[model samples]
Target: MAVDLFTPLTLLLNACLAAVVARRVLGVPVGWPRTILVGLFVTFSIGSAVTSFAEMAGIVTGGRFTVSLSAAFILIGLVTAWVFVLGLVVLVVLEVLAPTGTLPSPLDLLTGWKARRRRARRYAQIMKIAVRHGLGGYLRGRRRTDPYHGTAKIARSLRAALNEGGVTFVKLGQMLSTRRDLIPAEFADQLAALQTRAEPEPWQDIKAAAEKAVGRPLDEVFAEVDPEPLAAASVAQVHAARLLDGAEVVLKVQRPRARTQVTADVEIILRLARRLERGTPWGRSLCVFELAKGFAAALDEELDYTVEQDNLRSVAATIEGIAVPEIHEELSSGTLLVMTRLPGTPVGAAGPLLAGFTAERRERIAHRLLGEVLRQLVRTGIFHADLHPGNVLVGEDGELGLLDFGSVGRLDTPTRSALGMLLLAIDGDDAIAATDALIELLDRPEGLAERELERRIGHLMARYRTGFGRGGPSGMFAELFRLVTAYGFAVPPQIAAAFRALAGLDGTLALISPDIDVVAAAREQGRALMREAVEPGAVRAWLEERLAGYLPIIQRLPRRLNHIVEDLEQGRLSINVRPLAHDGDRHFLNGLVQQIVIAVLAAAATLGAIMLITADVGPMITPDIRLLAVAGGALLLVGFVLALRSLALVFKPR
Candidate 1:
């Protein structure tokens, strides 16, 4: 074997540089000696791994292997050293270019670099798809030149791209479908049809996944596992199976590498979003980073199979007059879910079944479906956010079955109250109340013209009110979303999703019975809520709750008044009220003082402990000093916690 003289020299220099980079850039808690050792270890490992890979490749190809092994190792080490130096240069350049105080953390930068490389193929595909679909124009600052030119073609292309890109992109398209404010109406409408469809993985792969999840062979877990999947989507595929105990169930197996792929894609999208936010006017107006963050959070929740199982159980418990599948928790994992398979035809395929019903029977079915949706929104405040036709099933007995609880919407008390008011206002044709409620529901942006917004909302409501039977809930929701965007109001994501779901339900119901009135159904639901609110029992409970909250205040008032009266009678009370420059100044000053005290105590204790450790003394004195050092360390920890708590309280939003 021959060795190059420069190899050792270069490796030594690289190791030293790596040590410096680790301490400076990565903040590694190692002294110079330890850092040098780490650097040497890393270099050696990389060299060995690359050399072994090269030797294996050579042997596999029936080429020279043993003769070139040492040479390959040296060559690999040299390349690694060069690459490490280049990376340091790139990092420096990035730091220099990044805006002050906006540079990413070391961990984030490393992760992002890895993600960019990992998803390079996906990124290339995205760009190609975007250009093909005319989305590249937006990146180039070009608005749609012709509003009507090939709109359908562009919409179709974009939908195709989203489908091809994978689950995360499909999910992004689904979210964009609700953002009528950001995307054009035609694009939004087209993207709404972008379903999560993908070819099913092989049965063997699914079986392997199942066995891994259950820690047993497929035969032990199930008496018979179907070879064909019942349904397949980007996230998971469903297969009908019979358990060993004779329980019929469906196994929802997550797609291979779905989580890892989705995560990498999300990181790439987030990086692109950050770039757009910095570079484009459209991105700025839409807040692309915030949108990406929200989408990522939603997708993460959906990726967890356990979340879906919990959602199913919760809806089944609270919702009535609907069939939700029974989950088998014992046989479920984060990647594999087992649930009872309900027998029914998809609502989309139920046209023939619905056609045989009389007009009155169809109306009843429509009413039942609409009523259940309204109940989900009004009474329980948790509802299926994706109520598309494919997710709903109709049994032979005419029972409605709701499936796919992966994407659900939840409303807090305030949001639900606002929604109820808006629904009631719309039902009664009260434009003014509807306008007020809509505005209340929105996070109104600064510098908004309130009166103008109110007038616009009134006009919107009037148009919908006149066309109530003709437009239905779908039209009403569409116009409301349009108005919300027009006024620059940030509608909550959950609220927008709910509106989308309601619009879908409205269309579905209309197919069953054209005469079905969504407004009338909503009005009935509103009346029921009102009736519940004012019931004798409800009113008494409300009164008691209010009284309980006020009892302490009421009891303290008399004593406070007595003290005041006594002070006045004795002429001993002196009032020294002073006007504050700022309402928060007093609290700020108090917090500042507390933080300073804590910081001083912490620093003093830490310093004492450091001094004790560095100082050498006799054995008898050293034991006492060690005890003091321990006490100082404990005091320092306490001080740090108190300081952090105080700072948190001080800076937390009021």
Candidate 2:
């Protein structure tokens, strides 16, 4: 009735033989080096196992049952560790060797080893460049004499260096620039200077690439092709042109030989990623290899003009209050994209609009953009993940033009609902609901206990609220991102990418208009829509539907609560607490923290408040000891009231 060890041994043998067969067929390295290491490890494991079995059997026959059992346990432990180490070695060796489709010879291993060494040297060089650039930037700022001017100059230099370093560095710089909490605010501000800008490619090269893409000369398809480029970027450049029908159009042309260059860069990055994963724990936690691969794929899609054109149209169709330039379908190709020309001032120049338009108009525009973005994220579960000032243009007539949809996100319905609840709960200051919503939205959707999920979410929510209270929008978002990235929150890659894009928008908006209250605008729009959604009748109807769906769980709440209490008492629950430092006066800090905590608690009181609150919490009070918590909370409440009133006023007029 007992299982035999020989059966498991046969499976192990088969696995090893399968690997050998695969390596031979695939033409990978099968030299003495790996053979020796594997042979030694296998011998060690087998010898240990055999000796333990012999000892155990001998002790059993000798009538020493306790000694035999103890020896058996020790043997099992040693063998388990040995097998684990060998398995990891085998997997890595296979990963490297399998790619080449052949067993590696000694020369191949030596070549790979040497290449790795050279790569390490190259990384050192890159690190040196980064340090020099950083320090040089600091010195340049100091040299300017005027602090502001000096910082600006250094920022400009850093931006140039980042762009020059190539695609990966540019993307990293862009991401880091938006994370004010992760880095010093000064550095984040400076890095924000690096937008999606590159020197335009020459006209001759553009024409040749276009011809190559379309499989004909530029003259064959168009009456006039502009030689001078309208705009340029690292991947593709844009040119203005005229069609036979007198249509003013812009042609997005892929950079000459960019595909090959990108491929080479990606290869380098992949190799570097593998090295980092092998050598550094930080790299492993970051999943550098996977991140690099994802970035490469995204950049590849961006290089295909046809794909970008499709994304542009898709996003425009999904989201209201935004428009994408019409793509000229007939004239489009993989590398050549022609779109209807749009005349608009860059959103970066919104300052000019402030001088001309009334404050209400400005607020309206902000509301439209923010609301539409949130709606797209909720309703269609899709959003532009690379929204920055340069990609958003303000027309002379005030129409918003959303451009460059190469990076976009699509959330599943469940995920979208959780995100909505997260937004609503945060605004309502309902920490418990926010925590639950975030856990469902962010972590592994299934196979998680409700209590465990809630505990972690609460901890994270508390950390974020604390940060938001102390450091405001820039701080809160930055810390949230760092937390998610560091802790393996299991956020899908697209969501992570979306976070980067939102951060970019935050930085750009701040630069354009410091007075623009982003959260307030978002709140005002969400509240007006949600107020109608959760009126007395609406609330009753919604509750009925949810209660119907969750009746089974609702009925068992008492039992669940008992289990939760037990777990908490036993200290079996884990929390995701993020620690933030206090920078303001002690009394003021305490008051602000208490107020945010109260807001969080109040928001949790009812789903209606969460869905309908229209207040900006970012700037309730300046960091000062004189600011009373009660007065600050009152001001926030008043702001919420006025915002709701304003919405009512707008609705009445419409």
Candidate 3:
């Protein structure tokens, strides 16, 4: 049977199919604007294409051929998108060279390979350690989730493997500890103790790195330089010293092999992240690729001591009754830093000193420490990210000081306010309010099931409100993160840092004052902020700021009104309207006009068709069929199709 391929049904169907094909091309915009443009282009293009092809092929061509062609087009489009995005991201990530900071030249390719060969020796040892620790299965994609419920043991094994992997993996494990939402609770807990401390770098390597950084000899710069390190960590080591001016100070020196070691490990980890993400459902759900990228970036930032120098100088008394150490600017360099050594033991370890204090006194110190953390969060917007006990010091008088300002979390005003509201809401057990605040604090989780999340939060509140059985601050946050993650949301890195800070402080409080309520302390701090915000002086300042914003408008209002009055009096009052220039106005008007015109044309044609077919007054081309009746039937089909198309366009997604 001969088929007319240019029929409205065939043309419309072809255009719609082509549009679906075009959407998979990916360069097309993601939403309505893209959909509209693509649909319009396909509609115009397919009409002309079908007409040209049908004229050449004649009416013997049928609808089945068009359907087959459209299906093939869609298949090819999807395949093209897959290849393009994969090829693009792989090329970008492969730019990183093993054991080197930048791309190696063609001449250095063999030399680079040789260096990497040496690195592979260390890498093989690390892998051996992983295999020995029973992490080989996980790394090899032979194991994913622990179906036997031995996550705790697996977590411990992973932590041990990382600890043995040396400085880089220890840091990676520490970074992973914050992602409680992604990893199991047992894993987060086990990895939480993954310390970055390593054996001290040899005195020669430390001294040489320090001297080179400062552009001077040690004897010329200091009265005495200690050979023994006071503390040692993966990236840097600290040594107690005395300056040329009889001042006691601390020297932080970067390890000589730190950069190269970290670079090689990061490359390996990234490759592992890719493999895991590709092989396991859990890896994709956890977004390990993105997590590794963020970890690498942070490690990159911490490699330079100058960044820490700026951080230490910038960590001021943003909270009242706190003080910061004075850094020696002349002695500071990207590879070395000199600062006054504070007099105190770590707050968490000063158990003997704190034992003498009354319960009220310990409570006060706890409140102050947590208050300082919150103050940094909402007020200054910059906070010490690693808020472990070792970073906090307690003097005999019970005053506290913060140390090691290398990693910090910064929040903008909106995020800070939203986070504060979230903390307060959750503490108060207002699930709806907490849900609202969470929507504001988090980046993704859009179009979230708000009522369901609130219900889940309500259940969480019921469970945790019964006392400290549900773990302390860390437990509460871990549960909260897991809940959000179940809804397929990724926790932002800054928010993760904030949660870890609070968790570390909770651990600190437990060491000193186990009876203290961490959530209550946070609530108290939030309440204090609220009180200060509403104080008379604060209210006056706020009102002044608000009024200042309106001052320009107020000044212009009178003149504008007077001009309007004069124009009215002089008979020059006129309103210039450009309603169509506005998007909402134009869209509504255009759609309304289009629909009305379509309806009129369709009704007139349909009525005319009925009249012509019923009149039976045209010349008969055949014995059984009249040309007039055939024309009327065609007009009727066209009018009905036009009406249906107009309806479809009206309902199409905007």
Maximum-TM-score candidate: 1
- How do the residues 1-654 of candidate 3 rate in per-residue lDDT, one tens digit apiece? 236645766656654654454334322223333343445455555444545544453321454333345433443343333333333222223322221134445566756888878778876887799899987776677776742278878888998998888888988998888888778888888888888878888899899999998898998989998899989988899999999889999998889889988988998888789877888767776677888998888888888877887777667635466555678889887778898988888876898998888888888888888888888887677888887888888788878888888887888878887887876776788999888888788855667787898999989887877554567878888988989988767777888888888888877877667778776677778877756666899889988999999999999999999999999999999998875788998888888897898888889889988987887677754344455765676676556645654554454435
Model 2 quality (TM-score) = 0.58
Q: Per-prediction TM-score, please?
A: 0.70, 0.58, 0.67
After superposition on all CA atoms, what RMSD does each candidate show versus the true structure?
A: 15.7, 24.9, 13.9
Clashes of each: 0, 13, 0
Output the lDDT of residue 314, model 2.
76
Runs of candidate 2 with Cα error greater than 4 angstroms are 1-162, 175-196, 444-472, 483-488, 507-514, 529-654
Candidate 3 deviant stretches above 4 angstroms? 1-108, 142-149, 534-654
lDDT of 2 by residue, 465-535 (tens): 43344445555666665554444466676565555665656655554455677766655655655565557
* Local lDDT at 576 for model 3: 88
Task: Write the candidate numbers in order of decreasing lDDT.
Answer: 3, 1, 2
Q: What's the lDDT of the predicted structure labeled candidate 1?
A: 0.74
Q: Candidate 2 deviates by what RMSD?
A: 24.9
